[model samples]
Target: MVGAKMSNNLPCGRFEMRISESLQPFIRNGLKGCEKEGLRISREGSISLSPHPVQLGAALTHPNITTDYSEALLELITPALSDGSEMLGFLTNLHRYVCTNIDDELLLSASMPIGDLRSSAIPIARYGSSNIGRMKHIYRQGLSYRYGGCMQVIAGIHFNYSLPESFWLEYQDFTKQPGDPQSFRASAYMGTIRNLQRYGWLIPYLFGSSPAVSKSFVDGRNSAYSNALEKFDETSYYKPFATSLRMSEIGYVNPVQASFRVSFNSLDEYIRDLSKATSIPYLDYERVGTKVGGKYRQLTTNLLQIENEYYTSVRPKQLTRPNERPLRALSNRGIQYIEIRSLDIDVFEPSGISIETTRFLEALSLLCLFHESPAHDIRQYDEVKHNALAVANKGRDPALKLLNKGQEVHLRTWALILCDQLQEICEALDNGNKARPYTQALHKQMEVIRHPELTSSAKMLATMRDQKLSVAELVLQKSREYTSHFQKTPLDNSVKRDFDLQVANSLEQLKRLNNASEIPFDEFLGNYFSKIPEPAKFPGIDRKASQVR
Candidate 1:
């Protein structure tokens, strides 16, 4: 067993290699267990100045499908799966299903939405008449009021992953950690999160696809690039060296969230801080008013309506019971998994994400788990946020610098260093004859670093330049092309049957919920909020029970 002192020094090249060699056997053993994953991808499209498709009723009622912020914005979710290929395949079939359903609308292929419409023209997503559905609908309305509906329409992919319990048990034994299996697993997951915060900037550097936006996206807002906006054609705006403008301040900036100091040290601290944010009222949001002209405009005047409202690059997550709050779920059971939220939808991929990208993310997650992660201070947190913004806006710039260990480092230089470490981790992950997809993915990223033009963002800009089309034009063209491709391709019979069943089941479930409610809507909301259980007196007990159930 490696001592704490020994593990602390394993962040460097030689030490990392030695540690990777030592952990290879355990890694292989862990891989033998079932590897599970969950994916949720969101995309926004226009409805030709008409109301959202009446055929696709209230987003709140759907299970596999839903809306993010705008009625036109569609979010497609895949149930958890162990295989990366299966996940992507399911997502593609979902695209096929949606393409067949919607009438006269194209999924916007770019991360940024078509910005030509008025804010009010973008309608908030509506759920049915049920109280829970109304809560979901009104929350989006609050989002539209707080952040412009246009910004909310910007779409991305979320990857939810959990290492099997067997892996953690083996890891605990290998590390000789002094705690129960549950506590060790929770600590490990938190460590992965902290490391991700430190290094996640590299993700956008390599995969960020939104380097430019239509001029209308920034028309009414006070933009830092307002002066630069005039240089492009009246139809488009861009940063010459940007990677993902979608992740920049222009996309989802919230000053109120910025002011709060949320800690990632432990589960208790996280739940406490997040809960406080939900309870504490903000003057700015209060001004928006919960009810306007007898119509509910927002959920509450709090900093956050719920835990899901707190936007970050990554989050610690736990599976919830039937109607359990996310915080309560986390409190009752420690962190079950973590969600990676920084990925932009790659325009070139019909699924919005590629198989290589997903494999690389899994590799990164493993790297975070295997490496040493020190507790971070608020200053470190702020630095990570700054680094993310810098990479999002100016990563491709030759002169860009990012902070590492309180010292300035060239972005490319730091990225290459991390890639080297990922290379080592990939070797550990690649068991003989099992395949080296992780290594292949890491190599691809290394090539992107070597050739800046190979990045998705750069390719997007180049295509626009070569084709002489605007951002909106290019995205719409691709969206149409992909729509045609999906429509022409037939789903596998088994896959088709499963999808049919899921849709049918989701509809039946919605009907059941609608009919089962016996209480008033307001009373339901009151009970829901009031019944949030306090942090469990015993942490590991409910977690084990949850696993059994």
Candidate 2:
């Protein structure tokens, strides 16, 4: 127990390394403002439903979490989303909600528990227990089991929805204006500290050297990877939230996809919790787990099998042996997990996002968790990322080929097949009673591939070349839009000032952290792996260091 840590109440548990007493107000106000922003997404800035329906699965969420962005609609909003005195409650509630998202669930049936799925007490280090926040006493708690250096996970409502300029303008007129890069950091847990300089809606966050136990999972020394950015770049869940790197420099960085994966304590409890949180129905498992007694066994009642007959032997070598694609896996790990990512603040809108998007995400996650299997082994991750990069750079190119079963296939053809599968899955979801919006949303993407204008990469390139904008310049554009929206929201002077001040503080802190230097890479990862998750506290948790370079 000397080196180990657990939840707050545990004698050796770790609380957020920072003190909560100093800035409770900021957390609360931020949470309150987060409510009801969902309308800005799923329903707005979106196309009509697909007639045939499509199932996007975990590729995107079906639930409209954007509304959860608005203080008016979220359970955790009042305290954290506040534009006024509601600050302390705001931060606490905000943290609780995020944890709940990771822990709780709502089933498809009407019956569900009010409490979030009972969660195993997790680590309290939001950014990993560094004792950064100064106002309260920080405690060392229990650390994660498999993953080491578990940062308190940061989760947000990712809605696959958008709104029109007209709608955003109206909301801004009535809301507040405060898009100070600093203030948002009050609740945001990210490593890329420099990117804050650019208030652009789109950001490129870097990943630190992710020396994972699974070598198959990490991509080290990427031409795209940034070192200066790594100071602020978190390799795990904290990466996507913020960055110190300039997006102008790193052409395309995958949004941080950080998540704290937990194997359930009990199936009944897990089922009850997710059912309410998601407002979905759950049926009995057809079979559970891959081998006997595995965590996935709970899912036994419901099985989604991809028949074995489908095999591919023909394709161009380049497409077949994707330098970055995963080799297909034979074992069914059955351990189901989800990643929480893809959160973009809708700078133009009042809520920064909306509700419909959250629900859509919810729907999408269930579809994927219950449906898709990793096409291959963990070793295939490199290819996965490589394919992603190719798409980001040349998604619209018809000649592009991607690896498929040791064969090359037209990227367009692959996309269409994936898209077609989505439609089929959506039709089968809940026995086809209702279709998922993500199916239709795929069209939004197809439209972009057909015409480059809609892709983020395309938009980014166009803006940089045509407008001659630097990263900061583009960020400023987004900031103005968001600030204008916030300012219009009715609020008192004190609240606005406080919010602005918080933003300023965050920015200062971020810049300072980025500017600071560190030890060598070998030493940095050495100290990092020491904290790898173990069942019982490994004696190594007692080790300390100055900082990594």
Task: Specify the highest-lDDT model's number.
Answer: 1
Candidate 2 stretches greater than 4 Å from native: 1-337, 342-367, 370-379, 392-398, 424-440, 464-468, 491-549
lDDT of each: 0.72, 0.25
TM of each candidate vs. truth: 0.89, 0.34
Q: Residue 540: error of model 2 in Å?
A: 20
Q: For this target, which candidate reaches the highest TM-score against the unseen true structure?
A: 1
Candidate 1: where are CA atoms >4 Å away? 1-14, 18-45, 48-58, 220-230, 531-549
Residue 421 miss distance in model 2 (angstroms): 2.2
Q: Taking the tens digit of each residue's C-alpha lDDT, what string does model 1 give over 1-549?
A: 232422432122334444434456655432111111111112343433544444444355555666666666777777666677777777787788777667655666667777444677677766666677778888888887777666777788888777776666666776778887777788888888988999999899989988888776777444554564333456888888888887887776666677666778777778888887777666777778988897888878777877789988888988778657888888778887788888888889876788888878877887787667878896788789999999988999988999876778888877777777677667666665467887888899999998899999999989999999888788877888887788789777897777667666666666776777567766766776665533323222221121100
